[model samples]
Target: MANQASIETRDVRLWYGEFQALKGIDLDVSRGRITGLIGPSGCGKTTLLRCFNRINERYDYVRTEGSLIIDGHNIYAPDVDLIELRKRVGMVFQRPNPLPISIRDNVLYGYRLHTPKAERSRGAEDEALESALKSVQLWDILKDRLGDRATRLQLEQQQKLCIARLLPLKPSIILMDEPCSALDPDATAKVEELIRQIAGEFTILIVTHNMAQARRVSDECVFMLIGEIVEHGRTEDLFIAPKDQRTADYIEGRFG
Candidate 1:
């Protein structure tokens, strides 16, 4: 049976002032699967990803139209609590961005935010920190250094920490935008492995410029061009036999 959609967009359009970045996109990202959004830099892959948690509206001039639904709720509805929405839909950026704090603090940041002070005791925080770190495969390596500064860790570990930090929030969907772009080849491979390890536990929608990464890490793929989705399908089907000529050309490196 097909997986239910974790995120669904219907005729979703976005604008930064007057410039349309996303033009009436209709897409579905399946629950507990990795979905890759691929396109050139100027395409709307990142824009569409940001719409999930309404992060695009952070820019004062940004505007959006149509429905962006996540887990059966329309995220754009006025009654929607942005904080709660963000808790359910966490995001990781292009580069590893750990805060200037201790490793334990970083991991517990989101948990602390959503949790009340009286309910958040040392024991609970410790358990959450350990669990989150272990989920991202960082516990063994960083357990002894919980008090160490997060920014001082290796890039790979830092990136993992960024991911680890999200787990405590119990997110339903994780949005990653070029998550490994800042890492070296070896680090990239390791991060990809980590991403694969965490799949099926959370719905992940990743935007990547690396076609190979998309193929390796994603179960499904989306191809966009000029602010439109050209094609979307199972990863193997899309890569092996793209239905759209534009998708084929781009995949074959004929053009972006």
Candidate 2:
């Protein structure tokens, strides 16, 4: 079946000075579906994720060769506006790194990043912030005490706040790098539920080490080895009956 591509990587290659990180990788991300990137450490999952935001381009030694298209625009092109690109493709990291400010402050950070000081309105900002918290199911828990320190919230609440923080921008896609890695089981479940609720609203690409998590949340799965993709297919087919020996071995827990 042909999936509508929300993001695509065509003959993409990455290098850190002379050392190559990604080897002519080709990737297709389905619109409004979850795509899981599973591979051992340093196999380039995070590197590839960073590419979506042109985060790789910021590093001095890093150089990219090929096309990364998002919503039909060649993002790797010379004139792509990186600031705007990031606003459209938001990211959540492995750790829940909330700001040292109030919960409301954390959620408004992205708005501040994209909106100019001259154009930003206090009322508009508040409305956007509240809407974001609601989207992540965090508004009720945080609504009463918007002025309290962000860290005062429970760890789970804080993580959701971090997610809430990003949602205000209404990004078309979200890149999650091991988002539930640091949470307890209950917190993890909450995060997983949030994923299900938000998947259809935003195109999501996740990098996870947990095989079960991949099977649980992903619509499509990509398995990589030594910086090269060994297999890519529908999550059910890949997990139930992977065609490649390496993919089968990795998923079977013989190797990562």
Best by TM-score: 1
In candidate 2, which residue ranges exceed 4 Å CA deviation?
1-3, 116-119
Error of 1 at 117 (Å): 1.2
- In model 2, residue pairs whose N, Cα or C atoms come closer than 3 Å (at least 3 residues apart or on different chains), thus clashing, are none
TM-score of each: 0.98, 0.94
The residue-by-residue lDDT of candidate 1 on 83-164, one tens digit each, is 9999999999998999999999999999999999889899999999999999888999999989999999999999999999
Candidate 1 local accuracy as lDDT? 0.94
Backbone steric clashes in candidate 1, count: 0
User: In terms of lDDT, which candidate is strongest?
Assistant: 1
| Span of ten consecutive residues with least summed lDDT in model 1 | 1-10
Candidate 2 least-lDDT 10 residues: 1-10
lDDT of each: 0.94, 0.89
